[model samples]
Target: MATFCQFAFFIAFGSLVSVHADMKLDCQQDFVSLVWTETRPQVDTSQYRLGNCFPTSVTATQAIFKVELNACKFRKLVTGDLLQYSNNLTYVSSELELLPFSLPVTCVYQRPKDWYPMIYNPVFDTYGQGELLFHIGIMNNDFTGPAESSSFPLGSLIPIMASVQQASHQPLQLFIEECVAATTPQLSPNGDKYTIITNKGCLVDSKVSRSRFIPRQKSSEILGFLQAFRFSTGEQVYVHCTLVAWDPVGLDKTKKACNYVQGHGWELVDNPSYNSLCDCCESSCNARKIRSTPLGNEMVHEVVLGPIMISEFSDSLF
Candidate 1:
């Protein structure tokens, strides 16, 4: 965390006061954030940007910019054993009299002798059992930062990632059977509930919202985009999802990602050859009559993400 300020003296309440437009930068393990706090009433925050990413949140006095470090076009420099990522935060006002300002920001890491590239770890939940480790996290828009936030507004898109870390070298497939959002962390039959993904991996929320399944990078992981919503006004939202690790070659009606395309009906994201399987999404997707035990590399895990306060005041970040 670093703070940079440009001060200007003024008189307020008949007393001499020093005011400054402060810029705070946070270079975390997973992301980089820049905040510009301006007391000048004439300044427009829409003209400010950190690299190509604009402020996700902005108010009369505060503007916040956040993005995955790798997603932003940060310049990279290697000096001997140290690696640096740098960017500039600039404020360009529309008024001719308001001078522009640019703040140089950089984050550096020490490169180890035997260092190999790896992803940064954020606050994530993990279920390590036997040879498989199942984990889930809420990520940034680009699926780079495993993000955590206390507040989200209605209509904001939330990116989520569920993955499996395996000790065994077997190809595995991941799926979200269903997910529900409630005001409480624990689900109750009487509680206010909104089903997002249902009918065996069908994103039913897409029928009403812009929620959809993201393209898969690997069979071992699944990414999803969920629009933030509320069951009750100003109440906390908790998302409970049923995740399963299955054989990539054995994708069936039960293990799939079906997103409701506006004009195209339901479409399979991972395997289009099984579009017939998604037909059940409109009706009912039944379980196999003869349920069999999961494979050695397959398992079912239940994960909960949130305590996210749904607000109407939060600005859309997407």
Candidate 2:
């Protein structure tokens, strides 16, 4: 469902002239839509825009604009646990002597509380010869959901959580060395694949899409979001990821969650101060010898998730 917002247009310059423009803002979980209506003074629909983005559809009296939440030059901010993105809409008369009117628009997403592996299905959990218990599952937009097969809208964000149950083992850190999506439940070497994560923890998909890794909440857990996509039209998708367990405090260039920023290159998500460790993301990350300790040997597991349907409409699996 869309949240409708109504804002009155105030004159920024020139005479008031009884000009009234009714603006409707549709703020959704993954995108924003806007409709600008001019009922009074006649105006050119082409002059209206949202942050340099023109209307996707326009008419004599109304101009409609639609944009994804992550695009359109929106300003992003992280305040505590809340994520905020904002932009402006403007209308400028085509007449030679007229001033432009602008309106501010914003969208905020807050993380849900106490969401974890307990709510997930035990079927998706994989045990590593009783030494480690690993679980991989899908999540709702707010990060709460059952760890079962789900459906997501194409081009939307898919929340995924990977965790390790340490039972009586030593403290550990979890890293996703690679993630690949295919049409079948089992990933084959020669099958068509879409790489979402590679180069150890580098999120290569983020370079072209909105896919990213969320901040770490626990040493044994790693959460991230993959932008919904498809390998074949309307075919169910499955994700296979290689999970590795390492020493919590022994992070190096080869073991890190790095995201590629347009201008800043690769950045370390877990700890920015350790950004130097992500410098190797642009190229190949060298392999390190396994340590002789329980946590150092790095328990590795390959986990599969999905049968997720990517559809035209939006829906959560929770």
Candidate 3:
């Protein structure tokens, strides 16, 4: 009976040893089999531009380490065809390590509209010179907000005019070359209207020059003229009247054409006493004009004036 018991015990011990060896072999094999199925990660092209691209798939050695380590804990057998096994192994490792190692890939995508430059010129009839200058700078959604303004020195105005003219493929107009102080329109209360008033000294319509340019001066006449023109409350008004000179001959002479055309017919200079003359002749000529507000009661005024240098015009325009 004792002998029989010994034989049974030996048989049970051998079976246990066999099972241990099989488990170790299985664990080693599973770990070695882990691999990456995808060579790289896929990239999303919609968000980027300028030929920018991102990666689609990635092959990583660390991912395999994770899969092997995880399987070791669970004593799980790795299953699947070679390709699928590799993919699963990679996925397992990715989950375990939580590593973010991605390769960037690239592909061509269509360009968006509003991506190109917008060029426009605003001319005011108030200035007798056919083209009064206003410049629009290149803007992008990322770098700048919807509304922006800048001031330039009077001297820089000429070069800026030349650059704008070149970019627009048009001849630089003589008026743009002259130095003039200007203010940007401020945003109204409702955010709808932008109004800027530039003091363009008393402009006489070529047809009715004599009627507006008479020599007699009086304060009452100026006050009356200003009051006669009604301005709605909260309206943005920019007045850019000449402080030192009415028709700036200095500005005209600065231009290349005006210098060469010595006696050109364009009456570049208006009478220097035009402001005083207007104040004396027209009642209320210097009174502020009222503007209506688009927003109920929200009104703001952004005013700028200067003895600005002509050379700094380009930076200010943008």
TM-score of model 2 (CA atoms)? 0.56
User: What digit string (tens of lDDT, one per residue) describes model 3 on residues 1-318?
Assistant: 011100000011112122311110112322322212322234222211111211122233112222332332221111111110111111112332332221111111122322221322212111121222333221121222221332223221111111111221211222211122222243234533212111232222212211111111110011001110112222332322221111111222221111101232222222332223332222222433422322111111122322222222233321
lDDT of each: 0.69, 0.70, 0.20
lDDT of 1 by residue, 128-235 (tens): 224677887888776767776757677888788899875532345689999999878899999879999999899999988889987665557788888876576587
What C-alpha lDDT does candidate 3 achieve relative to the native structure? 0.20
- Reference-based TM-score of each model: 0.56, 0.56, 0.14
Instruction: Give the top-scoring candidate (lDDT).
Output: 2
Off by over 4 Å in 3: 1-156, 159-284, 288-300, 303-318
TM match of model 1 to true structure: 0.56
Judge candidate 2 at residue 14 and give its lDDT.
22
Worst 10 residues of 1 by lDDT: 9-18
Better of 2 and 3 by lDDT: 2
Candidate 2 per-residue lDDT over residues 1-318, each given as its tens digit: 233332222222222322577767776677788887877555787788787788899989888988887677765433334444566677667564444545556665553343222433322212122368889988766455664448777777888999999765534579999998899998778999998888889999999888888775455778888888756658888889999987543578878998888788888887676788888877899888754442323388999988888887555432
Instruction: For candidate 1, give the lDDT.
Output: 0.69
